[model samples]
Target: MDSDDLGLFGPGSVTWKVHEEPILIVAGLRSLYLQSLHPRAMAGVAQNSNYRSDAWGRLVRTATYVGTTIYGTTAEAEAAGLRVRRRHARLRATDLFTGEEFRVDDPELLRWVHVTEVESFLDTARRAGLPLTADEIDGYYTEQRRSAALVGLDPATVPGTAAEVADYYRRIRPELRMTREAAETALFLTAPPIPWKLSLPARIGLNLGPPRWAYFGIAGTALALLPAWARRMYGGLGLPTTALSADLSVRALRLTLATLPRRWREGPLQQAAKERAARLAGTPA
Candidate 1:
């Protein structure tokens, strides 16, 4: 049965190579930072997401969905996508800026989320010193259309190349803003409370140690890597070398993480997928 399922992205795909990096968490955070800049997008997340009240649970669920889509069997990936589509179809939010109602699953909004997400991942991977050429980077964007489709977007309408993505962002930039909701989201991300799901002792530990440092480091890196225009919206006309410093910091972070034991860093979904792939190849994982 394992042999029959390689998930949405097999081990050979650039998506797998990129998403498996321990540093993708920074990329994920960066996506949140970027996506929140869109007023309607921020409104949808603010209205429906439980990150404020159940931050840990929300994190786990989002991770599960992403892992399942990338590493679970093909059926698992499709099932996860179906669950997302159904959930989205039932949710609506008021656009505070426009005083209008908008569906969470609106293709335009979905497109915004998809682009920010894939772009952040690519950007973070590159900055973290991943050895990717321009062609491979573009290929990564093309490969992400499968992910965009999972959330009810038409793959044909989604940007499939790096140039297309940049052009899309250019066309959409005028609509982006730092709404109150966006600013609040950024503040919460910078210093999120310890996940309530942890034991009291665990929460206390998280508040004081490397766990805390890691989270802040990632948050800071995300903020540092924001485009200059984004920084201006957030009230900083950043220094000329902001981009260069962000790149250096990411490279340092990646090197630090590479020293950790693989078993301690790899998530179960990723490990399991690798095991399945090995089994299919008659080799050990």
Candidate 2:
């Protein structure tokens, strides 16, 4: 069978391995924190998106887009990409600092979003004690170039290795800062609106005070996982996390998430992708 007829990344691909893990929820959070440091990109989100009122919806949509691109059939992936490109084409935002209008589809801004996400996903997986080699890590980045292309980025121009990612961060550091919108975004991620099903229990826990503290604790762990320089940008917005504590927290969380039942940890999309790959390999499914 053609590779496209199989899942986009297939079973052997590092993208599949990294994304299939439940720990990626943390990675997704880390990516958002890192992305918020970019004023223009963050402005586009603040001005044009309903992230404040519908934070969970925004997260679900982003996860869906990623799931479709990485595990869906080729046609499905392309269609999703087209939808995003069309939406971006019509959206415009004014930079808060510069007071200049710009298209959301601007390649530079797209690149910023793309690089931060890919780096976050990979770095989180590794730091969480996922066993990935140097070459495998590089391979994962190389594979993700296909993902970047779907969102209108040129794969060749995007960083495809750890060294390149570090250099990209160094070059882009000057453009990043902590703004009011960014600080607000961080707070939102920390204590987002709870889903209705758990509202009563959550309220009870909140009344007892443990839930609020636990929520901030989890949020702090997510923030601590960010690169040192990125964490520094947040400045006085929150308490600083030492590298040693961050490492222990990530590893412990990964270990805890690993104990979840396979059915609970692997979503239907991921299970279907694995079955597709098995069939393509002529193995029992």
Candidate 3:
């Protein structure tokens, strides 16, 4: 379904005022990436016939990341992380979440879905702590166009026309406030103005290519293992500082798995992995 159909938020709407706008936006973008990648890991979890019901249980937990990481206290965020992870472990390898039995096969539709989610994601990042500049926001839009190509959509056909693109933004305008002007203002207020600089290591980490063929499971493994020190190291290297947060780490796994190859990973494998992981950890299965 198109994000425009969600009607989740409104203009100038900040999910959590306590978190800086930029951080929240980044969090949102990260969340979108995870969502885009969900099918990958689903294979590792959907092994049982009842996988969908189990997955729904897990999503309810993962959704909490949006609340605790961006709005609640640190303790709350940490707690939520545990809850999501615990539920994730319950997924069955042979089963699928309640809805789709596979990742969307249409490349164009996937690209459009990715773009919409990324916009909302940036909105979340803005709320968390990103003091993005107009140039940076424009850059993000440009990059999304490129990313659309990665998933198999013609950039030229995307949005079809400037009017279409504008309409897309207008539809989500209610949930966002970091307009071209506001983003510019935030950038100007920072100690450094346009022509921003990112350290070499930071750039490397931030641009780290997507996972190998093992994306579905490995990403979740990496995220589940993410500790405060890991986040610090990644942050020190130049990724968004919030990327190190526990909530983000857990989410990274949840969404990545969802984007797996439909034939091999979509159903049973996804569920089995979740249950297997939980069993290994002796949590619950």
Candidate 4:
């Protein structure tokens, strides 16, 4: 397919159904927490990312890149992927524990980031009551290989089924660890600085109380929603989340967020994608 054709995945794809939901805010946090378990990946981020000083900015940028790749036109998605690749080419980092140097674009590191993010998104949406079937879950992973390819990973090498994902995790577990950098990244993920605009209202709402407490609550809940094995990696920090509690919390949060009007909940890119789909189907947009 041409890069200028309709984006990678179409409207009926599982990716659209999952990515369109608001619960992905939680998924994003979960992905970051999971990604930090890899020492080299954490070291690269600590050395190169401005996550501490401009956490929200970094998040917005990451969200934009994801949104573009998922919802933008094929040309746009490819362009965005090229930009990321260009940036990665110039970046390098040393493993904090092993004192080994590696490029940011190393395929192994890229695969780690890709699997964690897609798995997080799928898991969060499923728990939040998105109503995906077993087949759809597998299809979602298969579809995401296009996304992997965009970032320079060979699709054949990326996991494209639930079973493959499980096996990938098993093979990679030996390399995962809770390094000091990972712990600090976890802390930062839990309570990064609130944006100035949000901080002003938060200050007024509770008489200058740190708004981070509210975020901590949400992050704690997100952490609880993680799979048991993933949560156990953090040892005592996992917050004692049971499957029942996680299910209830996710459902409640999904319902609450659903109350917002469509215009408020849907981003411009998603809205545009819907309209384009409608037009393609010869229906009212």
Candidate 1 residue lDDT tens string, 238-271: 7768878889999998898899998967889999
Off by over 4 Å in 2: 1-4, 201-214, 236-241
- The deviation in Å at residue 57 for candidate 1 is 1.3
Model 1: how far residue 112 lies from native, Å: 0.7
| Total clashes for model 3 | 79
Ranking by TM-score: 1, 4, 2, 3
lDDT winner, 1 or 3? 1
Backbone clashes (count) for model 4:
0
- The digit string of per-residue lDDT tens for model 2 on 54-162 reads 8888889999889888888888788899999999999999987678999999999999999999998898888888899989989998999998888888899999998
Worst 10 residues of 1 by lDDT: 198-207
The candidate, 1 or 2, that scores higher on lDDT is 1
C-alpha lDDT of residue 140 in model 1: 92
Q: Which stretches of candidate 3 lie over 4 Å from their true place?
A: 1-103, 159-166, 169-285
Write down the lDDT of every candidate, Cα atoms only: 0.87, 0.85, 0.38, 0.87
What's every prediction's RMSD, in angstroms? 2.1, 2.5, 22.4, 2.4
Steric clash pairs (candidate 2):
none
Models 1 onward score TM values of 0.94, 0.92, 0.28, 0.93
**What lDDT tens digits, residue by residue, belong to model 3 across residues 174-250?**
33322333233222222121122433534566542332223333333232232233323223232445344534544
Query: Which pairs clash in the backbone of model 1?
Result: none
lDDT (0-100) at residue 145 of candidate 3?
56
Ranking by lDDT: 1, 4, 2, 3
